[model samples]
Target: MNDLFAPRIAADPSGWNPHLAAVLADLATTDAVIAAQLSKWAHGWGAPFSLGSVPLSAVYATHVAPWNPPEVTLMTAKTILWIATVDDWAERDDAAPRGLDHLQEVAEGKAPDPHSALAGALADIRDTVLGAASSRRRGSLWVKATTALLAGMKFEHVASAQIRDGGPPPALPLYLHHAGQTIGVPLTMATLWASAPQPACDSSLARLQPPLESASQAIRMANDLQSYERERRTGDLNAIALGASPAYLRTQIADQVRHCLEQLRPLLTHPCPDAQALHYCLHFVLRLHQAGDAGHLHEREQQQQEH
Candidate 1:
């Protein structure tokens, strides 16, 4: 992992923004809340494999903070845990399509098996997260984002199967487009919107289109860089496995990060505080992923401690 992303990681402390540092610190303080939520969910769902591997503190610090309302932080934390657990499971298991189908059914408002712990837990998360939306439009947006994430998961399952069957890696453009959705950026954005100070209209969100795409691409590249080795060993389809050299992948990731930051700069000056907060939150997560937490979960606790 270091060999693939050393250059990108080495340039990071300088790229860190001070304004977001305070927000991140505040987020880190939510560790107790996130941990409590995770503990409760673990007791009910039997603990995801990631419970021991990925620090809940680090996840909330990167994914749920800055925009999370104090009242709903616990719900947000649970949602993040659900997303991470489902994502890890899908990536590691060959039978993921079955699980994805179950989750999609639950997300679509189908009654999950009352006896199935995983299905029940997923339904609870879907309801609680989407239920917090202030308006039907925002709720629908959250549902749409979740649907897109599931679609991306199915696409990844197909790509992973192709790789295992000795087919070529997915085309670069195809990977990036699908990876953006698979990485959960859209869902995260929907969460941000749902928790924003005011309802975001289509036009307001449209203004953020460029930065959002840049952020998604940056996240995809960072994830690919950090996961290349493990993904290769696991027969997963990664951007790096598409025959790109380490140096070239590093350059591409750097370029994406720069573009993401550039696109976000103007949004920082937007009249809406939600728009500005969204920009900061997006940058915060991208920086965390670029710093290697997205794939290298073992280091997350240490990194957060140092921060």
Candidate 2:
């Protein structure tokens, strides 16, 4: 697993951070149960597209393992797989609105039968995560985040349709707001907070808001940078596709990540375990993108095909 963090110095990637590399080295190892459960659930959920396309192990090792134990990692993996499955479906067809409706109903506490496999997977993830939450407040926050993610997805679908119909892309601020939620950073954070060890220092979500937003923005920009080519190829919506040069986009991404790290620095020095955990989560995501390994499910497929 050490190879996972081996410096790609040959690239001299503008995003590389030594501290982030150290974090990756420390947390790259995953429990066998996580791997096994990921495989089992991927198959059972009828999400062969995820197995064939997305870099699931890489995503888990980088994003989920650092903040969670084996059981939580497994649960997080299931949720991620479900999200990826839904994203793939959304990209391929016009079913996203219906899917989002089903998810919204589930997130609102209704127990209606899911209308599709994607919806069913979301319902299952909601139940599993709520059952594992350390407190009712955290569970409630998770539901709200899920609903927010659905809304974001709906927004993306609308934006994509507009572009597909020959309209110009949305302005940068509007795109980032929608993209942040569509990227599911808030939902992922809620899950991490929910399953985190009991009584974490400075556990109030309010306290972590600024850093979360900063980190999420960084992740969103990094994703745009890393996946720009693939998005262009697929006629997909990306922040970079909003008419910016690659050089300009890279600069914005670097600035965004720097801001996130600055926000995290004070929290890390504050002796709060929850704040520290949130810091770790944000840093992990930042470094994953810095490594230039962060991309959408379809982007990974494109890489596979090219190779």
TM-score of each: 0.78, 0.80
Count of backbone collisions in candidate 2:
0
Reference-based lDDT, residue 52, model 1 = 62
Top candidate on TM-score is: 2
Residues forming the 10-long window of minimal summed lDDT in candidate 2? 1-10
Task: Please state the error at residue 280 of candidate 1 in Å.
Answer: 3.0
Q: Weakest 10 consecutive residues, lDDT, candidate 1?
A: 1-10
Which residue pairs clash within candidate 1? none
* lDDT, candidate 2, 1-307, per-residue tens: 1132335546557979999777756555453446666777667767433564334543553364355567676666666666666666777678668767877997777674644566666767777788888788888888888887778778788789888998877888888887777776777767767766555542656667777777677677777877788778887788878866667766766676567667667667755555666566665665666656464555576778999
What ranges in model 2 sit over 4 Å off? 1-31, 53-67, 112-115, 270-273, 291-307
- Candidate 1 local lDDT, 1-307, one digit each (tens): 2332335534468688888788768667666566666666666677443566336433543454445555455555555566777777787777788878887888889888776565787788677766767677667777777777887888888888887787766887887788888876667667656644465444466666676677677667777877787787777778878876667767776676567667666766655544564556555565566556464666566767999
